[model samples]
Target: MTPGARVAAAIEVLDDIEARRRPAADALKDWGLSHRFAGSKDRSAIGTLVFDALRRRASSAFIMGVETPRAIMLGAMRQVRGMSVDEIAALCTGQAHAPSTLTEAESERLASADLAGAPVHVAGDFPEWLEPSFIAVFGEAAVAEASALAARAPLDLRVNTLKGTRDKALASLAHLQPQPTPLSPLGLRLPLTSDGRGPALAAEPAYVKGLVEIQDEASQLAALLAAAKPGEQALDLCAGAGGKTLALAALMQNKGQIYATDSDGRRLMPIYARLERAGARNVQVRPQRRGGEGLSDLEGRCDLVLVDAPCTGTGAWRRNPDAKWRVRPGALDQRIADQDQALVEAARFVKPRGRILYVTCSVLREENEDRLAAFLAAHPEFKSLPARDMAEQAELPGLVAFASRFGEGLRLTPLTSETDGFFIAMLVRS
Candidate 1:
């Protein structure tokens, strides 16, 4: 398909997403299923255009003075793709299968509109209601931080030490030109393609052998900071899909018993195949039976309990730009409630003097520091552990400086840590 036709396809996908109030992936899939004539390359290009348009949706609407699908696509061409008015016009020349010609206002806006005067939320390409949360976290740099979240994310992988070393995995997957991640000792990063998609690493020999797993560097670091050591009995209370559970197994060198369970047992289904592929023998999957005593045997006996709490996922906006728009105040409230429940449940499994690592893929204070504060206040038996001290003890002293920015935990952001937004706090049972 011509570039013009791809742009038209993107506009259609975006319109479907808005009209149906559905996910971008679902809309794109429906479009692909209906328009089977479009080849793989055309679908990829259209998906990229659709996602890029959503990434800068607020800014695009602010510049174009309208929020229609066509205006968003046109504004994205100018602002994100760096296409000039003439260049955009050439694509929208009313040719067959191409978008209609741009209106005079669109042409003028594309030629001269700037974001300097736009509100912070519009400039940062995030929801207006989230402005205060961003400001609370980043202060004067909130817009810059939100801009970083709006940008594309690189693909990251964590080497499975239980199966192979990072060097071995890197050498095996060298065809992808993977680079060592800045902070995670076991992390490998692959740059996105020009079309803004990562390589199909799942098809690689290393990945097939479970030498590497597709996890963001921030998540790897969060597991590392959990500091699960050899021979320790650890519990992953919210082990969805077992990404961190596998990481914890690698960190423990497959020596300790790591029990993984989730409140929603269906989410644990994929962990079985993943565990077999990764050769993680030390890990055990404990599917929670409905209305049963959940891990009652391990209550107050575990050396470590990792609660990868649910959150708004504000920090992961770079990859899930559509979620940035979908998140509402009610959803955030529900997530906070979920986090509180997860933390309380995790605390029950942690042994005296053992640690509970609370993690979230959110930069919002209400979900991170604020939740920690509330947890500590409600449970006097648990004391907050300094994340820097824990990082140093775990031989990741580089994270100490980063952890200092937060009150009682480590916060990683795209702008600050070149990673997905993640918060890690360690609580020790006294």
Candidate 2:
């Protein structure tokens, strides 16, 4: 399909997404099923355009002074694709399968797509309700941080030490020109295509053989800060799919025992296959039970407890742009409640002097520092650990600069860390 036709298709998908208030992926899939003639490349291109439009949805509407999908698409061409007014006009020639010819008003709006007078959320391409939350964490840099979150993200992979070394995995995936990550020694980064699409990694031998696993650099750093030792006993209280459980297994060299479970059993199903593929021998899967009765035998017996608590996923907007808009005010309240409940579970398994690695894939202060503060206040037996010392001990001294100003933890954002937004803090049982 021609570029103009692809843009039209993307606008259609975006319309379905907004009308139904559903996920973009679902809308795109349904569109593809109905339009069977569109090839894989065409579908991919359309999906990329849809996501690009979403990334700049707020600013795009502000510039064009319209909220229609077409306006968003046209405005995105200027903001995201850097297309000139003449260039955009050429694509909308009213040709077969192409968008209608641009109106004089659209041409003028496209020519001067200035965002100087736009509101904070409009300029940042995020939900307006989140502005206060972002400011509380980022202060003067909140807008810049939000803008960065709206941009594309690079594909990151963690070298599975249980299967091979980083150097060997790098050599195997060299066809992609992977680069070593700046902070985590176990991480390798791969650039996405021009339209923010990653390669089909499942087809690669390195990924198939479990030499590498898809994980963001921020997550790698969080797992590293856990400092799980060889002879220690650890519990991954919220191990959804066991990403960190696998990381902890590698750190412990499959020597110590790591109990992996989640509040939902469905989320734990993938971990069995992942653990088998990664050759991780230390992790033991435990399905969650009704109430708070799961893992009762291990209470107060763990040397370390890792709680990868759930959040609004603001840090991952570059990968899931549609989610940023779909997030609501009530969702934050629910997530905070969930976080507090997870802390309660983590406290049960952590023995005296043992540490809990509290993690969230969110840059929101309420989910990170504020939650930790509340937990420590309620349970005086646990004291928050120093973020700088943990970084230095983890051999990632560079991360000390990213320590959270509001709490004893480190915060990583797309603008600051070139990684997904994540906040991790250590709390030791006294």
Q: Put down candidate 1 lDDT per residue, 1-430, tens digits, no spaces.
A: 8999999999999999999899999999999999999999899999999999999999998899999999998998887778889999999977979999988988999988889788889999999999998888898898899999999999999999888788998789888999999999999999888778999866788989899999999999999988889999999988999999999998898997999998888899999999999999999889887753668899889999999998899989999999999999999999999999888888888888999999999999999999998988999999988876878877998898787365898989999899999999899999
TM-score top scorer: 2
Candidate 2 local lDDT, 196-264, one digit each (tens): 788899899999989999999999999999999997999999899889999999999999799998988
Superposition error at 293 for model 2 (Å): 2.9
Poorest 10 consecutive residues by lDDT, candidate 2: 134-143
Clashing pairs in 2: none
C-alpha TM-scores of all predictions: 0.98, 0.98
Models, CA RMSD each: 1.2, 1.0
Q: lDDT (0-100) at residue 289 of candidate 2?
A: 86
Error of 1 at 403 (Å): 2.0
| Candidate 1 whole-model C-alpha lDDT, 0 to 1 | 0.91
